[model samples]
Target: MEKVSEKVRQIIQPGEHSYVFSKYLEPIAHVKPGEVVEIYTKDAFENRITSEKDLPSQILGDYLNPQTGPIYIDGAEPGDTLVVHIIDIEPDRDWAVSVMKESFGGLTSTDLTPMLQDPLPEKVWIYKIEDGMVRCNDQLNFPLRPFLGTIGTAPEVEALSALTPFNHGGNMDVPDTKPGNKVYLPVRTEGAFFFTGDAHAGQGDGELCGVALEISARVRLKFELIKNKEIKWPRIESDSEYMVVGSARPMEDAARIAYSELIKWMEEMGWDKFEAYQALTQIGKLHVGNMVDTYYSLVAKIDKKYTKLD
Candidate 1:
């Protein structure tokens, strides 16, 4: 985590044409490791829907989740690991919104899950924010915990949509991707084309409605490089535990991948392989990051104290 003496903290914003995250895309900005940056990102709809008559399906034309950049971090290269420390995420506006399109969401009818009934109506929900909580209704209130819905590096593939989360990390929508959390992503391209977008003011575990409290935000973060770490999936480090993230079609397989990576990490910390597995089986906690994404994301977590090999 080398520090740079640049006088200003670079702030990046997505231009009108900035639409996707792909390895072929050129970097909009470059900063050395440990250089702090601020990002101003549009909501998933490009912040075009302002009234009740506006529909999410109609607004999301070719642009899916709008991203701020593929910022280049110098000295990062393939076979290394890129570490991102989320410094802060604050809602840019006073209100946030969520939507259910023609056939999206966990419980709604979709092309993937055919039903004999008509598709659900396009609905939208606006939550008023104050006192650090969103007022959904008299009985339902959600606390404000802002996070990025998509944070990923360009994969080795030519161009992958920002819809799926994989080794390079995309729209994982994990609430754990918050302030003070550390996310580890593999470096596939030189400088690790890291991109972020789709800020959510608050989200439930499954995102059952396919949308959270979508809001614009000022995201503050810093980057570092872990040379030669060679990790497979994205990992997260919180105050109390370490989490391995896996995203796949069947949630069971995603859970398997998360557990698999956690075990590998434990083994790397010098514990006996069998003992690590046994310890994890007894103490590991499984978390659902998002069940509404194209690929379900699961996280396996264990306390650092239990992972001490010495």
Candidate 2:
């Protein structure tokens, strides 16, 4: 086991696009898995909305979604697979606030009265399990599954907004981010600058509001490179006995994208196409990872025990 210590983490600066790799990725490449590295990340609002204690007329629109790092892996490169195994996520606390009736949230109802810009900058209400259940509103009983809502790097030649998940990963709200899961992201740059931020204490499929129970947390990730196997998008495998195929697009399109990839994967594993399709419709389930991102992503979870892996 590597010694556990807090590294002086930096927050991805505002107005910066295409996080430069040579500087950030080089350092993290040296750390071993099981070694804890504490990262400092900004809230999605990126200080646009201050603490819930006070409300503001307008939030700073520029510095939103400042992810932590484009941390480079030692042997990572384009056409290679960067596998990140999550060891643990220690959120300073287990709770977050959600604002209903906002400009881009799901709780906006036609009949609900709008609150003034001074009604507490949209409170992110959180709850504790004082009685064996995490109590939110009287009716809400949430199961905690803390995850990094945004985790990706810059695309090859452009400054892709952190708001979408392409062949390059970005704000993907796949709930499989819980501990003990490994995510395989395709590398597009020499170092594969990886940054992760926007943590959620607990959330459901399709982060309808484009947010989750927001919180600050520390993540332990083990990084390794799979050389020479080219992949297009992101894939996740977990001890939960499932392999996830993720794609970004409209819901239907995303499903088609993920499903198509699954078919290819099945064939690569030597399975019949007809049987794979049959199994997909019958036993496989499609999960809406996040819909609010510009290009929504759909994830299909395939049970590992039943599928052959090479």
Candidate 3:
């Protein structure tokens, strides 16, 4: 009798680094619930800022970000959903820090820095967790929930508008994309061109400074299909809730886009417009996805109780 084979596969190519995609490969044999798969990822710096001396070039040149893997999963098709379970995230280094350059950071014109006095290879920032609060420097402390600042797929064109999360998921910086969370992205092409980058050691809601801890990461994802369900934008289901994530030019407009998408979700779950609005109104809250990008993103989460049919 022939033995039944387990469907396990690795998506990324070996020993390759920075700005290159793994050549097309066969899809994973099968993906079932409770199954897990590990993915190797490159740091957001993309091997540009390896040493203290290499930091200057990292900020000045390199106009854009490069990501990896648009891995196609078996039995995944358009109008279906892909469940990306983030089981673990381990960084290569002990500490990760980000420095905001004078002209480049999100707060480009604010009084963020006292003065521009010196030029160093890179700036330094630190953190302290005490009394259940996470603090950067001495003034800011947030409940420490670190996430992937940049996790998305490629756009139709190779060179997407730098710093935006398009239909094909370029730079959607959602803080809730943390460990033990599941990010569901819409599949634009035959094999969803998935790319994961911008792993942060820690971050705030907006990533106001324009960067996260900026480190390399190790992650595991489990892909599953949501059949007979059609979603227009990215939707996520974490341990406790479901959210519709969308992006647009202005912040307020972005929030509306996300909210509208969530309404679609409500309708699909058999709620009328009034019922959907009421259900969402009770549980929905908007998130400032990423303000620094050219076009910002907003995610609307409809609490699990609203969607769970028991």
Candidate 4:
């Protein structure tokens, strides 16, 4: 609740963080639609693993992905669509961390994918961020592509952990939830308790090792509301593509949910359902969000040109 700027309507500090998304949590701040707010967030591990010497087994707590808010939008109600336009995301620190947990990640032996084999080694990699690049070491480096790993509205009755992603949009970890994109979330509860955190400097598809270049961030976002317009799943709009996200188990189910939702959206926009399905089969693109979370997330996307209706 520290006030950092007079220009920003609301400034939520890292102290105003939560581990779960629930309607029971008090609103940290309330804002009218169209207000620009700046939020400061901790990394996925809550900034616990600072160096390569810090291992997940020794430092991580019972919870991860500490979200920043349950910010109440003035007029948002059930069945409305909450639109969040990400204006910018700046890394608050010069370093980020990635880790490999013992019983986690895509290739490791997880509780969901049990195996007689031993667990993977618990290790951490600290990446240096300089000149807008994340340097893993002298041999590899990539441009920083910061995005929110967990961003969503609360569900009607469930108090879900920040680690899971589903219809309510927790921890989807989609790379598309970055700057210059508008994320549409379904509001199932009054006020649409919104929370976001788990900033990543960069992450590849599937979030391969179950971690990204986790970094603290200064995120600026604008909120808007679509009265009475209900969406079943999270949707994204970038400069040229329209995307829908679906989180489920057995990756293929996630893909089906994403594609099905996209087809339904196209139908609502006036395209015939069968034609839309056929068109999507030929031109749709699927991007893996995260294969490491409790549920895998897949994004179905199509370029704007193909979405233009006569």
TM-score, predicted candidate 3 vs. hidden true structure: 0.77
**lDDT (Cα) of model 3:** 0.62
Per-candidate count of clashing residue pairs (backbone under 3 Å): 0, 4, 2, 0
Model 1 stretches with alpha carbons more than 4 Å out: 1-8
For each candidate, what is the lDDT? 0.83, 0.63, 0.62, 0.91
Q: Give the TM-score of candidate 1.
A: 0.94
TM-scores vs. true structure, each candidate:
0.94, 0.78, 0.77, 0.96
For every candidate in turn, the CA RMSD to the true structure comes to 2.5, 5.6, 6.1, 2.9
Clashes of 3: 2
Taking the tens digit of each residue's C-alpha lDDT, what string does model 1 give over 1-310? 2233444475666455355567787788887887788788888887887666688767668557888888888999999999998888878888888887877788867767667777789977778889999876787588888988889888877676776777678989888888888999999988888899899998888888788889988888888899988999999998889999999989999999999999998888887878978998899999888887778899899999888754
Off by over 4 Å in 4: 1-6, 13-16
Candidate number of the best TM-score: 4
Per-residue alpha-carbon lDDT of candidate 2 for residues 1-310, written as tens digits (9 for 90 to 100) = 1233555333333444332222333334343333345565555655344344433225445344666666665566788877877666666554455543234443442113354443323444446533333557777777667777777655777766665566677777778766777787777787777777777677788887656766666776667778897777677777644455465555688888777777667667888898888877877778888866667788877787667644
Ranking by TM-score: 4, 1, 2, 3
Candidate 2 lDDT for residue 20: 27
